[model samples]
Target: MSQPQQSTVRNRLLKALTPSDFALLQPHLELVATELRQPLIKPNEPVKQLYFPEVGFSSITTQGSGGKVEIGIIGREGLVGVIPLLLGSDRTPHDHFVQGPGEMLAISSQAFCGAVNESASLHKLLLRFTQVQYVQTAQTAFVNASYQIEVRLARWLLMCHDRLDGDELRLTHEFLSMMLGTQRTSATLAVQALEGHRFIKAQRGRVTILDREALENLADDGYGLPEAEYARLIEGA
Candidate 1:
């Protein structure tokens, strides 16, 4: 397999690595295509590898008798499997699956753990990223409990748009309901509301952003904090 270009890698966590730190990981990184809905980590199962996306995003979700709800998203901005690494464990507490189709740089958990153990910079960077993920999860809980479905939907769309390469998002109402932890009807109604406002156009298996600024305005405080935190922490690295 071809080695990843240290400076050109798209994953924010990897890109934030110092030259020496990245070099320790570069030889072990393997570029691989990720399929939509592919499960990368299962709850209570050993996390065998880490995935740093180059194009798409993954959903980190919690499962219970009430079913599953997405708590956070990881894209080129972060890596999957860090939670296990951070806790010094081999298993995850939640399920992680690809939400968008793209490519990722895959590294075996053994290699990643070894690198983290050897590099203080890598250890610190990963810990900071874990904080960003915590912020996202907490914000999502607050949004779900306090905001209207339309506002929540707008926030979700804006998040996906941030990670995606284009304005169009290939998502279905059923999937949106699952992500929002709502019924399909609620998701449809929220989509209709956004469409009526011309903020987004919903179609078969896709939603296209028409006015990102308006959507941002609708999302208000729900969408920007965690993103800003990511920038603040990652850019300073």
Candidate 2:
């Protein structure tokens, strides 16, 4: 790839690569558009491609008889399919799906695994990202367990805002329910509470952030720890 082409890569994991490491994987990288709610990796299915999102976010979710709840969010800052690749397994326990519309750079899992095996730095960086993702998942569990519905909703909104380019998020109540592992009525009530506080505005299928500071305040400690860890581990790469 040309210098300018490499320079234009937006995924943080790709951007963190040393020139030599990047060169090793460059030929295999394919930029592709992704649609909202598209499944990048399905549960128990072999991961054919590892995705590094450039412009949107993907949700790592676990499902049950009840439904699915998001455990982690992956965006420009992280890569999907790391667990399966690291484990030398082709399938993952969780499902990964695009939560918003955007583009990503994808590499076939076999190619990515080959590059990782050959590059110590790349291996270490990806391992560090896995750690960061673990923190995010653990924090999500903490937030869901300890926080109020409104507070959890605020924290979730902040997460989406961090990943997306703008304040407006095109999300439905049904989707919010799925992400939060709550009933739609409960999600609607939480949305109303945030709207009442002027922290956000919710329409039929979208929510617009009006006051991020207030939303953060509402979320309190539920939102910052994992984010700080990600910055500490990934941003420095």
Candidate 3:
């Protein structure tokens, strides 16, 4: 893989870094392809590559009595495999995998740690991003606990829309059900509800956002807080 041009980099965290901070990790950053459903990191396994996604999104999930469910979405906004590293660990219990197909700027765990240790500013920036994750996960918990299936689906869709390049999301009902921690029938019904409201048009394998504002209004407290936190902490920092 080749090194990515700084100006052409699309990852929000990478784009937000100062020249000096970016320079510290530039030599080790390798642009790599990410395929749909590819496992980026596995539970309790040593994390080898840290990916800063440029185009696609990743699902951060865990499994238990409730079954496997996603907790956070890492897209162009953040990096994976660093949360454990930042906390002085080599791995995590959470599962990380590509949900969308695209490219990621990847680095080895060792090199990433070296860079983080070498620059106080870089470390600060990454810690800020970590905080963003905390906010997102917390919001996910709140939304899932407080909202109905349709509202939760709307919130998840809005988050996916924020990460991808277009309004059309290439997610099937089964996949959406897995992410939302609901049954396929429930997810299908939610899709019908959203389509009925003209907020989205759902097909067999794709969903197109037709009225984003309506979805936002419908999902009022289900989303936005964490996104606002991201903008305030990382985008502006």
Candidate 4:
């Protein structure tokens, strides 16, 4: 079947596509609006689609008897469906949810597997992406274990800022509580503390960075690694 003319969507990865690569998968690339708080994959559910986020953040979470905690966040630097691609697994042990709103390039799992099998460039890219995910998982564990809540929040905001390419973030404290595996009261307190230090300005659902340099100083050492890795992986792509 003939592929459609390449899409001109705003997704960084989609836009970076070479003409030949874009044409080869143009018919399969469906542009979809990713909604915040939407569940991309249920825990322990079948992996049916691979999402290439163009402008949003998706959180990979592991749930316990208490609640869910975010283990990693993926944006334009990586793909969302790594289970099927790397382990040949059909199901996801973790839940995938959208943390921010933006456009995504979503393709079916079968199509993704086919593309990987057919294209050496794609296979290599996916493998490198798998490595990035590993790094994020490790860093998240380090952050949760060794860092204070305020520092962790700074790191989180910095990571989000790096992806969003802006200083302002639209989010609610309630959702952030879930992401951080903390109580809502705790989250509120953290936000207030950050605000007091002029690291962020929080009003209603929006939080704007006031002094990133100070935040970076407070973010601890592990925080900068992911930001640097993102720069190396996706800058100018």
Q: Rate residue 29 of model 2 by lDDT.
A: 85
Once superposed on the true structure, which residue ranges of model 2 sit more than 4 Å away at CA? Answer: 1-4
Q: Model 1 — which ten-residue stretch has the worst lDDT? A: 228-237
The candidate maximizing lDDT is 1
Model 4, 218: alpha-carbon shift in Å? Answer: 1.2
Q: On residues 1-237, what C-alpha lDDT tens digit does candidate 1 reach at each position?
A: 579987788887888889999999999998989999999998898898999999999999898687888889999999898887787788978999999899999999999999999999899988989988889999999999999999999999999998999899998899999899998899999999999999999899999999999999999998998899899988772
Candidate 1, position 141, lDDT = 93
Those runs of model 4 whose alpha carbons end farther than 4 Å from true positions after fitting are 1-19, 233-237
What overall lDDT goes with each candidate model?
0.91, 0.89, 0.90, 0.78
**Poorest 10 consecutive residues of model 4 by lDDT?**
1-10
Candidate 3 ranges beyond 4 A from true positions: none
Considering lDDT, which of the candidate structures 2 and 4 is the better prediction for this target?
2
Ranking by lDDT: 1, 3, 2, 4
- Select the stronger candidate by TM-score from 3 and 4: 3
For candidate 1, the lDDT comes to: 0.91
Backbone N/Cα/C clashes per model: 0, 0, 0, 0
Q: For model 2, how big is the CA root-mean-square deviation?
A: 1.6
Candidate with best TM-score: 1
- What's the TM-score of each model vs. the native? 0.97, 0.96, 0.97, 0.88
